[model samples]
Target: MPPRSGSRAKSTGTDFRAVEPAPLILLKGSEDYVATRALDRVKAELKSRHPELEYTRLDVSAATPGELSTLASPSLFGEPRLILAEDLAQMNDTFLGEALQFLEEPADADVTLIFRHSGGNRGKKLLDALGAKAVVVDCAPVKSDNDKLDFLRQEFRAAARTIHPDAARALVAAAGSTLSDLGSAAQQLMRDITGDITAEEVDKYFGGRVEASAFKVADAAFEGRTEAATRLYRHAVATGVSPVAITAALARKGRQIAALVDHRGPQNQLASALGLPPWQLRQAAETARRWSPRAAADAVEAVAQADAEVKGLSRAPEYAVEKAIGRVSASING
Candidate 1:
């Protein structure tokens, strides 16, 4: 029989990191890495409790009519079951009808249904139903540096290890913007290091990678260090970082500084308004201090030209990027 209305199986909008095993779990967001991790946790927890758990995977996009019911039905031996239904965002009409029907009278407590919807309006009806009844785990994209730092901290905290905030920032800068890459780097550090992780340790392991990144060049350029920016750009390009990547970094930096040039509101308010972390806003504010409105405009123009040049407008993309770096540095210095 279906569980009572107020059963413990329902969660009140749980985060991906805090997901618990439930009869109906919905990983609803666009971030596959976080969703996969949450699903793995649920699977592990279920396995620990039911050693002989019958695991099944269903592609809801290709599901046939009544497939979900067939899978959720009791087996002869009555072993617990875990049904991981993926691609809900691309579910067909047949699956959608069955899913809605299944929701009206869900399977027994021994059956667990996990739905992975990677964002869309394709299955809004089913999503609405799951949102009200299932343990909804948000698997939203972690795009900002602040969110990435939180993820890194959680990784260490999960293992009962302490990661210095500076170390976490360093890892984020070194690891690029990919969550999976950052997670793997954190896991490797936790496995290899003995004590609390430090910035020094992070640098020792990833300093070269950081040096080769376009961010280093962009940072130096925005700081008005012309020589350092030029040197870093050359080194980054030599290390296989493309001219396009360098121009992209410069464009991003310019946008950040330009956004804060004339802002007079409270720092936190501005950060929230701009959808940027406080630390990032603080850094941009520091750079903006040296930049007048005209200078910021000039930097933007310079970055735009470089972006065009790198994207096939000019043959000497390397020289174009170097020229853009020099112009940005000069504008900041002025």
Candidate 2:
């Protein structure tokens, strides 16, 4: 799957299969196995329900716009199939315009067509048009520690293994959040350990402790710890974090801080306003303690400037990002 572009952009994962008796579904998110795993489980259930199902995978990346029109055709063999178009985002405008027309009246056959577009502006219009008829979901990057842990549990289940709770936490923190990496780490752990893997076994093979700690970048910046934040920002950037990505992180944090001090009503209401779960209120409260209205206001301005810089309005994305970090850190600390 491709990566999501811009805020609010949804990611597409694997194809979706129907329940015993239901319409086709869509699970949108990152290249994470969660969505892919959902597809797998759906297929598993579909098999027992309807054994005659057929599956088709198509890579639509290099195909010309005219070629895309061919996807609407029925399968050569008369069988139920799940068709996945892997690179729908790369499809040309001509293809997208044509797609908009077909989405309105899709073929109601035994086949289900799933278009997996990681995401971007390339086919925004067509995708949005299919929103009501088709499921248009955003597969943003994972942020919650719990979500990552749940992903780890799913991994263990796939291996026909069970891990201790503490061990799962260790794997999440030690392995980082990417699905492919987590799966590899889980397999190695399962293979290396003869029996059910315990938390103790995790410490021996995993090695991402320091890397995941880079999340400290946001913690320090929001708390106004300029020194720690600056050092961590440099380290994260040196580790290959893009200037644009770093700036986006700041933008996300800034929005979070702004939501905290939204004094329009009881602070509890702020969670929904921020699109964060209720548990985030604890962290928001703590982070808000260090933030003044003036500081949050300034941080917002800084992110706006950085966005322009990284987006090509300015020649120096790195310098612009550094400036935003400094401004936010100082404001939070001051």
Candidate 3:
């Protein structure tokens, strides 16, 4: 029998960290770092109080409605249980109905249910309904460099370690900006070197991730380092770097080169006009020397196309980015 919708309580807010686990939890978003940490915290808290936990992981895609009904039903012994339901988008109609029905009634206080969702168009109806009642945790993906740096700061602080600000940026540069990689790097650094970490230490130890920043990739592409830039692009993408970020970097670099190529004035005046720092203007001038004005225009056009492709206009975003890299490299070298 379906339970009444208004019979059970709704969620107070989206602050999952403070809230005790309600009967339903909707862990939504693409940021694995935030979501995973929250899930771990919940499990740790639950297990600490109840040493013997009845945890069940559900596969809604394959499990029949009958199986789900049996699993979520009140146990005879009334043991505290933790139910984890993943890939909500893949559930069949019958299983979806059964799951929604279960949420209508208040579960035994001891039973906690967590639903893991990787954000997409699928399961919109279920998500909208669950948002009202489920303790919603937003694990939205962190795409910008600054946000990733902030994440590193918090992670390091959590371990009672104070990392220098420059060191945090250095870590992002060296570790490819992904939360998991950054977290691992933080632990490794803290373990190997006692006390506060510095940028020099990050460069010395974890230099691999830093070796391929978006700007560096753009520099290589514009400087006609075809092999090098292409390799860096692949590494960045694999390490969860956003394609949009890469395109933005390329566009910025292209504009700098264009400005340098067209400007005819005192160095300071040109720098002011282009809004580039002295060091950056010098670097752009050097790169611009290698490419003709026509080539610079071509590079700019390529970046624009790549931008469109990555924003969902093209089916293959990664390839589109790579192609843009190749075009820019070829133009500069031409």
Candidate 4:
């Protein structure tokens, strides 16, 4: 994946604004947020160039080659056209031949072709062919903790403001690692606070919900930190995170730990099996060591009971979750 653009504008405050439009643009890889942002940039630039530009969007995965060829062909009105071919990986062999043949000759000067492909080898032949003629921009996922931390810092910095490291960490912990979610959280935090931000300010803005996030609460509970887990649970509930989401997180974490026990593979393979990032796998492995296989199974059963109780069986959902947290904590200790 290509490195994200470095320059920032005062108004847009993003690298996308600096990108010039390309004839055959390939947004490669699986980072949805990044790819979407890049796509927006291209559209914005094109709109700026020709206010009345005609845009023809086609999902190549579904559209026939004849349809795509006609759309990409020169328009009768001579108006500039912006052609978007989404899901390039699903482009059939027939369309691939037509597209490659079209690229062989010079295209209409007024036309721009943007191909969006989520990562995979499904259409490697097409991707390689386009590489010779396309301006490829990588949109790979952010995998490491440090990279995510950098993203948080850059987001704040782009706004001509700064966030304290502890505050940033707390925000990431609560918001989860996905870029779209984190971006939304950052916007909320900025809207709710002014001047330099601190951990206390973050906690206050989120109404003490940072520690109460499902992942944090479950992490504490799974390691037998009953006091911390209970406190977080109360705060999370008070802040309006649904009880269902809370219990669901608990059940998922418990299941991950239980599954880790039965797996006998390298950490990377184990992480892949569990659909977790490497760092998260390490955390789950550490937590798994605190429990016997029987205890882990018991915790999973407790979580299932909590899930049911919170939904309907119990009148007091809060107390049911609290009791489940205690049960799981004891299991970890055992």
lDDT (10s digit) by residue, model 1, range 77-121: 989999999988788899999888788774587889999988778
Winner of 3 and 4 under TM-score = 3
Clash numbers, per candidate = 0, 8, 3, 0
Kindly provide the TM-score of model 2 when superposed on the true structure, using C-alpha atoms. Answer: 0.46
lDDT of 4 by residue, 158-205 (tens): 788788765665565556447787777788888877767654455455
Candidate 2 residue runs with Cα over 4 Å from true position: 1-27, 42-54, 64-69, 75-77, 135-138, 143-147, 153-165, 184-197, 204-334
Residue pairs clashing, model 4 = none
Worst 10 residues of 3 by lDDT: 4-13
The C-alpha RMSD in Å for every predicted model, in order, reads 11.6, 14.8, 9.8, 16.0
Instruction: State each model's CA lDDT, in order.
Output: 0.81, 0.62, 0.76, 0.72
**In model 3, which regions exceed 4 Å deviation?**
1-20, 191-194, 209-334
Which predicted model would earn the best TM-score?
Answer: 1
Residue 209, candidate 4: C-alpha displacement in angstroms? 5.5
lDDT score, candidate 4, position 241: 53
